[model samples]
Target: MMDILIHWIREVDTDIRLGRPPLAGEARSESLAVPMMLQCVTHELLTLDPSLGARYRDIQEWSVQKALSHVQVRRMH
Candidate 1:
């Protein structure tokens, strides 16, 4: 389950990097919405399984930071 969630998160990160729309059913208020979405997903996952929260902390942090950087760059352009 952890592996699956990690893989899905990576895919979402890639979609964000490519400037693609949110995965089919995902709701987004703006184009650069991955960071917020990722944060929410991370929080929910931790809530679901507190034991694995620590294991995913680094990934959640990195992905959110990366998405934020992308948003900043886009805004500057």
Candidate 2:
């Protein structure tokens, strides 16, 4: 179920935010995959039901921000 997966992802995100250990064998550092996956899932759900966009707007923003945090701005010469 997508709901179950979202719940689990949110739980792990919360744990990571609080500096707590993730599930056994899971990486502690922030992984680009985490937010990317959430964004992908959210996009798919929104595509299925347009009305759900309102409910997931916050998630969309949050995932976008999370994913952006991985970007590095470089000054190349």
Candidate 3:
């Protein structure tokens, strides 16, 4: 579990590094819309049962996509 979490953290850090840094005027408190789900998955796997963690990953993806679409719809209005 620790190994996987470490790997995820590395991937997230790499994503941030490869992506553009935020604009100077932008807020840092608000997270990037896309990777927020990754963060959620990280949190869940950290706390949830190790045996069920893989299933949690599947659930996390579905939940994040649903939430993201809802947010997108609101933004489009």
Q: Which of the numbered candidates is closest to the native, going by highest lDDT?
A: 2
| TM-score of each predicted structure versus truth | 0.48, 0.68, 0.31
Q: Compared with the true structure, what per-residue lDDT tens digits does model 1 show for residues 1-77?
A: 75665675566445544345566877644334655666777788889889978787887887677667655343554
Computed on alpha carbons, the lDDT of every model, listed in order, comes to: 0.64, 0.76, 0.53
Query: 1-77 in candidate 3: lDDT tens per residue?
Result: 74464454345544333355767886544235435655576566758667766755754664465446546443554
Alpha-carbon deviation at 2 in model 3, angstroms: 25
Q: State the RMSD for candidate 2.
A: 4.4
Give the alpha carbon lDDT tens digit for every residue of 1-77 in model 2.
76666666677456434345557887557667877888898899889898998888987897899889889999999
* lDDT value, candidate 2, whole model: 0.76
Pairs of colliding residues, candidate 3: none
Task: Give the best candidate by TM-score.
Answer: 2
Clashing pairs in 1: none
In Å, residue 3's CA in model 1 sits off its true spot by 3.6
TM-score of 2: 0.68
Error of 1 at 48 (Å): 2.8
